[model samples]
Target chain A: MNSTDQNAPLLEVRNLSKHFGAVRALNDFSMAVRPGEVVALAGDNGAGKTTLIKAISGVFQPTGGEILLGGQPVAFATPQEAREKGIETIYQDLALADNLSIGANIFLGREPMRKAFGFLPVLDRKAMAEAARETMKRLDFHVSRMNAPVSNFSGGQRQAVAIGRAVYWDAQILIMDEPTAALGVPEQRKVISLIHQLKAQGRGVIFISHNLQDIFAVSDRIVVLRRGVQAGERKISETNHDEVVKLMVGG
Target chain B: MTSTSPAQPAEKHVAPQADHGDPATSLIGRIAEGRAWLFLAGLIICFEIWSRVAFGATFVLNPFNLQSIAIFAVAPLLLATGQTFVIISGGIDLSLGFIMGLAAVIAAHATNMAGAAIPLPLAMLAGILAAVIVAGVPGVINGLLISRLRVPPFIGTLGMFGVARGVAFLLAGGTTVPVRNSWFALLGNGRFYGVPYLVLIAAVFVIVMHYLLSQTRFGQHNYAIGANVQAARRAGIDIRGHILRLYVLSAMCAGLGGALYAARFTAGAAQAGEPLLLDSVAAVVIGGASLFGGSGTILGTVAGALVIAVIQYGLVFVNVEPFWQFIAVGVVIIISVLIDQAQRRFSGGRQDE
Candidate 1:
């Protein structure tokens, strides 16, 4: 793994808080992801992992706190704004349009256009197909039917396509929610390695997962949350599954 | 939930092989998607055989029969064109029928009023433009109800259906609005070189619709939203705005259909599109578009519409009861949906939990 000590943080959330009526969904949560590093967020159900990621990804306005990108404080009005600022959140089972091709999925909202007959604008299908081909290839993933709908692809392949989308748009920070949760063993392994490739490319990743093995396998640091608060943070090399589980369900 | 295994990178470099599996299955898949064309071809052959056996004449080769069928298809086809977009976006516009009727009434009134002081051709154009624009009003309401207010599509459009129908009838004073413009009548009834002007207009309109659905970003996004709206929203699509535009576009299509109807019969009836709602939706379904959304083509709907026209005209040509048209269309729609279901099961079998 490349040493991220010399690199500055790509994304930082300081004292973030979110509340829905009387319920504190997330409170006083702070984290930083540096270039070429993967930070795994570990928590049990209702421990505010989703809340934190949603707040960071612009799905929800934080009740209080600040998010900084490249040393500049930023507030995103919507997820689209976050994406434009290079923050992409790939929600589990909610990322790919099953009936669309990989290229179409990659260029969903922002489609490439070229003039036909020098006036009429049309979708640049050739450009989309070419980008899909190159993006998947760049991720070390291959699917033969580049134009086929993604419903034909397995779970892991779909995950790769989602990652390919992030890569194609040059997203600097990727927050993946349970990326491998729906995949088989081999497919899960494939997704882990895709994360490895992202880390190698100097992109920051916040991998939220319940699986300790997946978190430990690709992440450099792990942050465990309990009851909407940070329970513990540890280096992967220093912590084991038992200790992380203890942090998740504190006495 | 608690399975722990060391992650290995051995399988990382290996590409997942395409698992479409077997030539026969793929052949079935292809057949399923293009079944609308097959149905149209099969219907033609059947009609041709029936014509030869019953009247010793060829049904397909008769220019009069072909022309009549094309004319018969225009109104329904136009409505289906709009329905195709709505259905592909995972919604149905039930108000399109009354919307067409409303447009017809508006077109008749507008044309007659304009014809009193203007050139006939200009008056006809003004009528059509008015009908289409007025038709978009209900569409905007429908869009607001469905997209902004979060009303279910079926209920929302159905509500518009009643409202449009009542308004159209009220505007016409419960009678058909007779058009007085000679040019409007000529456009509806006249033809060039053995082809009806109505057919030509519809053909041009259909071609444009095909382009809009197949070649534009709006079309692609329609498919995306239908297939998985959450994914589309997350991908940064403006769902509410798109829905608003979509409904407006649909209403405008229906409006055009109504104006054409007013031209064809030289009168705009409040019920001009009352019977066509079912036919339009059937054409879309028969064309291979799923009502559940996301997988249809305009070309398919064309074939579907032609199939209905042929069924209606052919049944009449063969001396079948007029009521048989309803039964026959219903059967074909069911069969198309069955084919769609079988195809989905065949291909979507890989979507495992």
Candidate 2:
């Protein structure tokens, strides 16, 4: 459905492998995401979906293989490096400080500072508040108190705040790990709509979910993993839930 | 994908007021945040009434009584300032008390040696500098143990507490080390513009600390770390480095408190801050900082310290037994914690809705 599907891959993995001692958590896994496209990563428990995402997001180094971004081979030593290169990962646990305001959550590590009295540096609070307002507005999410701590928000709103953080930083590729797993039915739909919004903005999204229905709804293509390797890859239009489930379990 | 419009909805403007429909909760929230000041005001009023009824004298209006109370607050307030940062970071520095004692003993010896070779003002400065720097030794070790070795903060700091206490007593040669420097005594006892010089110094230090904890990036990161360390790590914050620096800063505060203690008493005692540790922690908690971390203010701690000082001084001023002061402070701490728990439940309930 993405008009820019013909565009060069925003993030590409070639024969990526990650091993932990005697265990081959992910082996020779490969995937590609293009601009304005949504790629669903679906697999059963312990199927190596987490390993593949973690490796791509720079949480762990691959035992073998290469990652290419924008057609150039690259490697990230840390998650911060990945983020700096426009690869943002939203974990299922949600990396948000519950006691902090949405704006504070948005700029946790990378706080913007303004000079006070033309010399001493201080937090630019006005800028943070304004950014929170604009970012949430851009996400089509509305909350009464922009300054309220994210803890007071519902699961869907908290998910939006995390996405808004990625959006505010202008991440080109988003890897969401089970983002809709814990949300209510309505909240899951809201998250799916948010993914659509991300696609409309020409950003690449790699959505990981257990729900085959959610994957079918938002993703253009699904990449299924089984036992640390690529199980099958299929276009949404060319496949159905039965076939995807078969790929997840293997034969 | 369909083109998703990014325009704001008309109803978006109405969201703020709609969520605030419960004005009573908002009012309670505001009061909770400022409860430290409220408690202090209430304490003062009670004391004022008691003084009028029982002693036929003024409690708050007397300049001497006010000065004595401010002096009483000084050491505890300084120790509490450091404790405030540590507590906000979701850690405790149990060694702060002995660290202050170690610095006090070191300051006395350093000042005596420096006085023999240097001018009076320079000697005083040298002593204070030496004490603060030396006090950072245990702090560095504390940081290393807790951050690098992955030891629990409580256990690590408790170990350091013993280490510092033993070292302080050893350095003091099992007795108080007397300082012969007149300048040190002047700094401790002298008054400027109707205020003690020590009080002025403390006021300035507290103001600077308030800025550090409220206006700076370090302060914000501190809150983030305390609120959720996993989130902070995910955000790319340098946790180990920050923890190391944080301990050093905390120790330096205790060091300054120790140096001031030596100046005030004109001697360095191994037990200089032994009794103040409890007071410092109590001040931070009474100020509304959650022991679990992520919530506290330096100003609130200021009010908390004043509350304790007033309780101690007011009780003595009213001819009440000094032992009752402990009971009164304990009661206030319980009351403050109860208020914190109630506020937490109130806000926590809204998350589900």
Candidate 3:
């Protein structure tokens, strides 16, 4: 059950489970995210945080679960299917095409196309560059060279580009897997701020992170998992870091 | 949620503007992008000067030599042009030469019966259709194996090489198939407005391929698929289908080259494509396309084929032994691949973007 407002949750995972051979990666998991909410996912290694995220984003299919979007049940056969359902996953690796221009990557699979002669449509590069610049501006993210390859971008900037790609496509649920790991203190902070910006725009977020400070900084609520099961769920205001830390570790 | 600002984004850390899109990537930027263009130009200049000094006049690009060069350059240029598509997609077609040879044999037999039994124009169409079917069908098979069956591109294409060659030999009965159609001869050898039709055809193909590689979504997908297959797939790019189509296009390009060869030579033989495989690959690499994949242009390839022409003309002009041409091409391939390796190292092998 959800809170008493009666509006449908933006994303709801009910009785979700994933099994890899004999390993139970996720067991009878359930969580809900409402509009404009940031739900932090916290756990140690092998705790099923990543597995659940992958299940939600269509990287891995949940062996048993009902993923309901706005009260309508959905099944994602591929990652593209999830994206079509307005769910975007920013994987740990960033998945940016390093060789393509920032604008190109921003509009990778879905480039602005115009028919040249007839029937054979080509990329309208001018349109792509303009749209990319526009979307980045909306995110308050700036890059001097929009036409340059992403391989030239710094680690953080590349992450920003990856996030921008989801935002540009109007993804309703942004699922970030380890959004802040391997980043500097400042780069990490930038990502945290970007998450706030995403929430401000009324998009729901499922943020998975090992950093307690980062999780505490942005989440409206925290869901803790341990050993492939839901350990606990707590409202940020109702619980402290020590309680969440204990839930993540074990008894 | 917390209202505090996130740390400053890392958007301002522009390093030394040594990247491809920088102004430093000017005409020198363009030339610096490919080893073949840089070395080929220097080679031509050196060959021209040496020819002028040694011979009474500049025999390097005289009309007689130029015509011969154009004729010889046609078949290989077509093959290299097609190879550009495959290589940029991080794939290769080792069977290209044999595919062309097979197309030529089919076209020869088809055209031989055209004037007497079929109409001349219809015969030409039949000849072209035969070439396309023979070459394109196998190419599709190669694509299926590589994409659907998970066969390595090198092995699949190499297997195609042997198969196509064997079929060509069987089709020709270990001999040349004579072509007698005068129209075929004209297209092969004749010219309008003082340009060899063969050269003209190659130039037109260059423009078409350049457009295909640079101006279309298909071209971008090729780069994307080659640059990073996983990223491409996650982007929802149909990698398997795209790769299948790419192999077909590659084989068909060789088919077109074979059709043209049969037209020009007035005969088709299994061994016709023996030298072409090495020559076309050399020309492609020399044109600035990487064998390691994800970067190449048809313009560069055409220029590369021209480089071979210049070398052949220059060597003959300098009275170099016939065997020296083979040695010279071998040396060129080695040097070009070396330069490509150095480029890969310096660019960190990640500039396909």
Per-model chain A TM: 0.95, 0.95, 0.93
- Per-prediction backbone clash count: 0, 0, 3
Model 3: DockQ against the native?
0.36
Q: Which candidate, 1 or 2, would have the higher lDDT against the true structure?
A: 1
Worst 10 residues of 2 chain B by lDDT: B8-17
Pairs clashing within candidate 3: A99-B353, A100-B353, A189-B7
Please, what are the lDDT tens digits per residue for candidate 2 over residues A1-251?
22344577888999999999999999898999988788999888899988988888888899999999988898989999999999999989899998888899999999999999999889988899899999988877777687777787888888988999999999989999999989987778778878877887878899999989888878889999998999999999899999999999987
CAPRI quality band, candidate 3: acceptable
Q: Of the candidates shown, which would achieve the greatest DockQ relative to the real structure?
A: 2
Per-residue lDDT for A1-251 in model 3, tens only? 13344345889999999999999999999999887788999999999988898889887789998899888899888889999889999988888877788788877777788987887667889888888888877776777677777876666677888889999998989999889896877777768877877877767899999888888888889999999999999998799989998898877
Q: Write the per-residue lDDT of candidate 1 for residues B1-353, one digit (tens) a residue.
A: 00112243343454555645467877898899889899999999999998899999999999999999999999999999999999999999999999999999999999999999999999999999999999999999999999999999999999999999999999999999999999999999999999999999999999999999999989999999999999988887889999999999999999999999999998998899999998999999999999989889999999999999999999999999999999999999999999998888877876543
TM-score of 1: 0.95
Model 2's CAPRI class is acceptable
Candidate 2: lDDT of B69? 94
Give the runs in model 3 whose Cα sits over 4 Å from its true position.
A1-8, A20-22, A116-121, A237-241, B1-29, B341-353
Which is superior by lDDT, 1 or 3?
A: 1
